[model samples]
Target: MTDDLPVLRGLLASGAPLTWVFTGDSITHGLIHTRGARNYVDHLHELIRGDAGRVQDTVVNTAITGWRADLILGDFARRVTHWRPDVVTLMIGTNDCTTQWLDPVIEVTAFAASITEVVRRARDDGGIPVLQTPPTVDLHHAPDRARIGEFAQAVREVAAREGVILVDQHAAFTAFSEGTGPGNDDMAWGLLDDAFHPNAAGHALLALGWADALGFDAVSSPVRTDLAARVAVARHPQWPPA
Candidate 1:
């Protein structure tokens, strides 16, 4: 088993309730993109519960819409540490990288420090910290997608330096989108609700990524699939919306 898996496995083995907190921006909060539908965060909790008997895991989402790394840092104690989580996942940086050309260096430096502090705080609170790179933006233009990619790299650097579990969602989304065809544009559009937020289909792709990152193969559940399908169809009648 991977080093990261041991702690999670032990948590499951212990049979005690597990509290996991997911903190980030609108993505983690499931904004307009997932208003009435299930997002990655929702599916991830279910994915972890799986078929494990008596594994009661509570997932607390402290993410707010349009929150940047600095904003998150300011509210860390009240939103994150107060939950007393057993596992804490940090997935910020999307907002921090927007229009980064205006303050590229500051964005990089401040973003990195914010991520490092989040992980450090989680550790100090006796929670296992997991770092997730923010998924890419659909816009391929100058200050949008490329800069987000840069911030994703910053997240990777922090994960390595902090020695926390790294869930490379940015890379996973890129690969998943690339498999669709030639340029990354088409796949990027296919998954996004807007330039930034993910639709239900995009959320499913995210759930898959989180499962892979956690070293757990997801079991298809008819209940969850049906719920997702109903929501997807209701949102957009088009069969292959994504």
Candidate 2:
């Protein structure tokens, strides 16, 4: 048994390149930004490169706007098979929770099963699977917390049972937004204009949470000069106050 443990550790520590596949909805798709590069997936790439010092990591974002779990499962093999990622991060279920068509519990269960299947398939290819619970939306406006919470719990249960890592962004974001943690509510200013999709601040939070989950230190590099200029422009008003 002692030898077996070292053998397993050796297999896991072989220093292979890591490909991270991020799948979800519009938030994962990086909407409402001037460039197509303001989503959490992009931020995650930046953090990994900055901290890991030339790791062989690639992030493929396959999150389409308004997509539900069923839709994602239908296309999984075709879309996700080729990359053979080292880690796959899945954040879904918000849209499914919004639907009144299916039983919430059943929908969530089926979603969990579908996601588990994907993780298992990735395992067959030597990939690590991670689950990210959907973030809490401004439920006061739409008020789907009960259903969303159920779905989030289901995801967490699956992660635990499967021994996969789960990043509970739902809990993290709520704590941050409600003034209970290190989150910046003002950061939600333009990012969560509709409360569903996040702006830059929301993406930043995602990046930070992902870094924590991956056991990596937070990114310490100076912000890109061009990005800083854009952020500065966003902070200041236009000339003559259009």
Candidate 3:
């Protein structure tokens, strides 16, 4: 078992209810591109509540659309602290990548520092922190956020430095897109709804990654989302950036 699995499993084994808080940007907000489909957090909710027998457990998404790491840090106490979560899942860096380039004050190092502080605060509140790297995007489609890979790396570095659990969604998605990873996901189908957010198909992979990290094996359940993906790609194959 990986070091991270035990931390989450121990909490479940404790026989007490688990309170999970998911915080980040739009992707974590699980809107727009989802097209009325359930996002990753929703899928995990079913698995945790249905399969894991944590029906009483509370899972909340405190993410705000278009928000950044620093914003989350600034509002940490209210968004995260008040809940006193047992497990905190953080996925960000998409917007931060753009602002780090366009905005004078926000840089990669500062982004990393802000993310690190978020994790630190979660830990301080007696919560287990899990860092999820933002999924890879079409660099051609989202040029302003081209440096997202660097920010994704920043998350990896922080997870290592903080010794927290990490779900490397960026790497996983890249491998699938490039035909390098197990399971036929990646670019064979349209994982992204557009340049900015993931559709239901993409969200499935996100949920799969989280379920794997937590030792749950809830398969993708986006039948309608899959059909939507087919139609989307047929209409615009290059929308996802090649």
Candidate 4:
């Protein structure tokens, strides 16, 4: 999270009501494995409301499972502009990076274009767009993790060109997985519900990133780590029944 995003800074300082639209794929939806509540969007909404003195916000999740960037594009008009969101976070690209279904180059290129259009639409509709790099995938199943990086870079480039806030969730997940920074520990494995969809702990990481980007004081680092640990331990397959 950087301090240079004037648009986001303005949004935070206004202290007015805000409608936040989160659009992405399964990860954003946090489906079957997470039961929805544990996803980052939900956690972020909760954190926003917890701070009584902060901005009053309405968070809406319009993400669908197994959808690509094109599909999301089709719904943007109806799902986003129609709702008139104040802030929009777009976090797609996982399905777009699939190795088997489509041409990687074609898919990624389309993805980038779609994301750029999404940002444009959001801004045109009087909303500030926050572009998020997709979280890293499990290397075991996703051998072409490099493709993921390419897609993430595309998001970064789009954010730079569009002058919108960019949250580097991919980097955050990598750091968390590697345990490289201060208070960072090995929490990546437990973060995943499977090879793809992130579990509760994983979503917390995303929530923290978004919170940090928005300059919110909610959910401290230690708290996030503890929460991840709790989720991992409680849900570990070998744990005895209560």
Ranking by lDDT: 3, 4, 1, 2
User: Worst ten-residue run, lDDT, model 3?
Assistant: 180-189
RMSD of 3: 4.8
Worst 10 residues of 2 by lDDT: 1-10
**Which portions of model 2 show Cα errors greater than 4 Å?**
1-15, 33-37, 101-106, 144-146, 180-191, 218-242
- List residue ranges in candidate 3 displaced over 4 A: 1-4, 99-102, 180-189, 218-242
Candidates by TM-score, descending order: 3, 1, 4, 2
Best by lDDT: 3
Error of 4 at 71 (Å): 1.3
What do the candidate models score in CA lDDT, each in turn? 0.73, 0.65, 0.79, 0.73
| Model 4, CA-based lDDT | 0.73
Give residue 71's lDDT in candidate 4 (0 to 100): 81
lDDT (tens digit, per residue) of candidate 1 on 35-94? 577888877776666643335778888899878777877888977889999988888877
For model 4, what is the alpha-carbon lDDT of residue 143? 67
Q: Write the per-residue lDDT of candidate 4 for residues 73-176, one digit (tens) a residue.
A: 78778768978998888888888887767654446677789899988888889888888998878766666544888899999988887677899988877765
By lDDT, is 2 or 3 better?
Answer: 3
After superposition, the stretches of candidate 4 with alpha carbons farther than 4 Å from their true spots are 1-4, 35-37, 52-56, 103-105, 144-146, 179-187, 218-242
lDDT of 2 by residue, 1-242 (tens): 22122433353367555677888777787776424456778766776655455366677887888777777778877556677776777888778787544555346678778778866776776667778888776665556534777888888888888777778877765654443223344222323545466656566666667666765544354434333454333332222224
Clashing pairs in 1: none
**What is candidate 1's TM-score against the reference?**
0.82
Worst 10 residues of 1 by lDDT: 230-239
For model 1, how big is the CA root-mean-square deviation?
4.1
RMSD, candidate 4, Å:
4.7
